[model samples]
Target: FLICLFGLLSHYSDISDMSVYYSISVFSILGMAIIIIYVCISISISIDERYPDEFMNQDQEMYFPIHITDD
Candidate 1:
């Protein structure tokens, strides 16, 4: 995250066109937001699993695995 942030910041001053900078900034912000959100959710789930009683209701169940037979 810091890597991407730094990379974007370093290119900030070089953008002579406002439109280009605006687009880049928008995409960068969105990408960072998604990455952060995913990481946070995954961490939360891990912690919740560690304390099962605190998050048992949040657990998810998977259906049976698909098996293929020869034709």
Candidate 2:
């Protein structure tokens, strides 16, 4: 969020003169990319923290069990 805000502030002049549609499109894409990167990093850290046993077991089968139910 801070990165996106900083980017907009830093490049405001470059985008200000562009059409409204174009400016919004550029910022939206930039914001989405930043959010995606943040989510990926967070997930990686959380998985590492939650699964220390799995992290240590190099040869263990890497499969997740799944169950389905109708509400």
TM-score on alpha carbons, each prediction: 0.50, 0.54
Q: What tens-digit string does per-residue lDDT give for candidate 1 at 1-71?
A: 54665566557676566656566678778988999999999999998776554444333323323334359
For candidate 2, list the clashing residue pairs, or say none: none
Candidate 1, clashing residue pairs?
none
Which lDDT tens digits does candidate 2 get at residues 1-71? 55665566656565554464565678779989999999999999998897655656655535533323349
TM-score of 2: 0.54
Model 2 scores what on Cα lDDT? 0.67
| Candidate 2: worst-modelled 10 consecutive residues by lDDT | 61-70
Predicted structure with the largest TM-score when compared to the true one: 2
Computed on alpha carbons, the lDDT of every model, listed in order, comes to 0.65, 0.67
Instruction: Compute the lDDT of residue 41 as modeled in candidate 2.
Output: 100
